[model samples]
Target: MNEYSLLVLATQYSFTAAFAAMAAGTLYFMMERNNLTPEYSPVASLCAMVSLVAAINYFVMKDTVGLDGQAASLAGFATDYRYIDWLITTPLLLAVLPVLLGRSRMNNGMMARLLAVDVLMIVVGYIGEVSINRAGGGTMTGWWCLLISMACWFYILYVLFAEIGRALEGADSYLKSSLGFLRTYLVISWVVYPLGYLIAVLDLSDNLLIGREMVYCIADVIAKVGFGMAAVSVAKRLSAMQWEARS
Candidate 1:
């Protein structure tokens, strides 16, 4: 009926979903590490790492789910742990791009720059979110941090698409094709974060909180587990090709 109730329900569901992601990630990592090639271990492990991070976040946020006004205010209305999760996991997710594309193609300098920007995006975004709780000039600081974070995000996308274009152009057919889907997936899946950010910050309605948690839960599953599978697919294809050439 109200936003609080909705958020309470959403939070319960999120716990289940987050746990599932972590379990799936664990299974994936074990299978890949034992059965798949060494090249895929990093991808599998990173996937597991992000899923585990999400799991931790859901646990951290459990305390604030359905409290009333005074209780909620005392408990802190926002879940800063989500941003901390993002800070750790996002760069790991992005690292997949270079791993798949080959470092020479992505280049060490560009990769470092991308990671730095990614860190900035999460850190600034967290600062912005927390600043909303401050008194006096807090609102303005929050907006500024958010704006800077968004700029950093857009810049990262620019590097992924515009700068990486040349490298993709020269990639083999399999890599080109697989990476095409990956690029599209990254763009689409990432759009969910800003929407989550808006909802989480504005606290527009209880439904918005519900929407935010659900979106984040679904997005994590897709971004981490789904993308990990994609990397595995590419690695498998490459392995198969190598075998064929040798045979």
Candidate 2:
């Protein structure tokens, strides 16, 4: 196979791996959710939903980069697929924060605002990506689109780091430490998406255009599945505590 075909196969297999992980995560979250207290149940459901949505999305994604390692399918829907997945799954993933932090402890309005910004970030980023797609390369419009989206992304970082990370009043040390790692995980995993876009915007390398999809596949698994696993574990602990207190 040629280089393009190899890249396509790599991307395709990466998506398959993501699909398998998410599918497994869904089952795991669903099973373990029953072990949590009712108050902590929402996080489990949200985690499962995030995995379920991405799992289905990745299953379809397996088709977009083309079958048999050809660019036969990446035409109309390819650009929109991931954004749609993000539109649905991102909010759900973020919503888990408020649940984990406890609604009483978190600023509901601020959290709501953060989720709104997250949605806008994805929407505008999608617009920018579509512009790039239509141009078959970078464009001035795409640059501005990405810049605005990055602005939104910075706001999200503020919310995550400043708003949510600022307080942990009733949280145990274990949970506090988990959130710390999760915050860092968000920092590490979430940044890859925009950087992938930057690779395209900068026109860094032709190979990266194909390779970015592989990067995204890896990031999605880490962001969604890895995050879900941690969230569920935390919820399980909290539930056990709640159950013990009741006893």
Candidate 3:
């Protein structure tokens, strides 16, 4: 097959794998939600909903990139779908972090601030990517948006590591451990996004575009499925602890 065809196939398979991973995790969490602690039911449900969004996003994303392995025309809904997915799923994923942190610890104001940062990060990211690919607005505009998004990202990491990390010191040991896993997960797995943006958005070459999509697909599976599975484990542990206390 030609290089373009190969790239298309790779993208198709990669996103398909992501969809499967997310969808499977969704089902698993939903099925087991009843057995979890009452507090954890919402966590399980949110995991399922987030994965469902990923699964749907993958199917829609297939059309965003043409068979030539480049981003398709922006005129169609397909090109805009990525932003839509982020609009929905990004907040959900961020919400999971604070929920796990516990409302009493995080407080409403802190949650709102964190979520505002998350929204800005995603929105700026979307603007950067769409401007690069669709706006005909030149690379500088997109780069500027990307730079702003990066600043927001650094702020988020600071909160997680410096602020929340400090707060976790007096928390339940199990919660501290689980939140640690989440912090590590965000740093290690979510970092792929900016890297992918640099790869595809900077150059916009066909090959580089394909590479970007593949990178994103891989990151999606690892972040969503991996994060959800890890959360499930934490929920299970929390449920056991709660059960022990009651018994």
Candidate 4:
């Protein structure tokens, strides 16, 4: 089969797999929700919501690839389903990090600002994707949207590192370390999306395009399910921090 067909199959199956993973994550988190103390209860719910949203999107995306006649075009991103998925899910995933710290460490203002920036980042990145993917550029052209989105991304990281990390100053080492790892992993996974968009801009070979879609699907699974599971583990640890003393 040709590259377009190959890309569709590869991504379709990948989305199916992510769908299963996310569904499992949602069930797992919901089952564990009631087991946690009130302080950590929202952790499970937040995680479940993330997984559920991702699962639904993956299902829709895979179907779109196979049935909605997804096609590659120099004029526009073929897999814009992924963008729609990211628009909703990215903010929820971002919320996982701060929510783990509870309201005390991440106040309402901070959480709102962080999520707002995340929305801006994704929205602008989508704009960049559409602009650059167009046959001869959409409204804007070439890297402006990409650069602005990158700046927003960097701002979010600044908040995570400088502001949120400050809030984490007195947290247990285990919790802090776990959060650090989760944040890094999620950020790195997120990098794949923009890189794929860049590849589209380069007008790379179909092989590269196929590879990009496959990679994007795999990374989506990791980004969604991995974050939820890791967040659950960290939340439980923090919830039980007082177990020894109380016992």
> Which structure among the candidates has the greatest TM-score?
2
Sorting all predicted structures by TM-score, with the top scorer first, yields 2, 3, 4, 1
* TM-score of each predicted structure versus truth: 0.84, 0.92, 0.88, 0.86
Q: How far is candidate 4 from the true structure (C-alpha RMSD, Å)?
A: 3.2
Off by over 4 Å in 4: 1-8, 67-78, 136-142
Q: Which ten residues in a row have the lowest lDDT in candidate 3?
A: 69-78
Superposed by TM-score, candidate 4 places the C-alpha of residue 2 at a distance from the truth, in angstroms, of: 5.4
Model 3: residues with Cα > 4 Å off, grouped in runs: 1-4, 63-77, 135-138
Model 3 per-residue lDDT at 141: 72
1-247 per-residue lDDT for model 3 (tens digits): 3333566667756766777787788898798798788877777888888889888887766555444543343124344566677678767777777777776777666667777988898888877877777754348878898889899888888877888887777899889988898888967998988887776465756656656667777888887778888887788788888899999
Cα distance off (Å), candidate 1, residue 199: 3.1
Tens-place lDDT per residue, model 4, 109-130, is 8778888988887787777766
| Clash pairs, model 4 backbone | 75-134, 75-135
lDDT of each: 0.70, 0.82, 0.75, 0.75
Estimate the lDDT of model 2.
Answer: 0.82
lDDT of 4 at 209: 71
Please give the RMSD to the true structure for each candidate, in Å. Answer: 3.5, 2.1, 2.9, 3.2
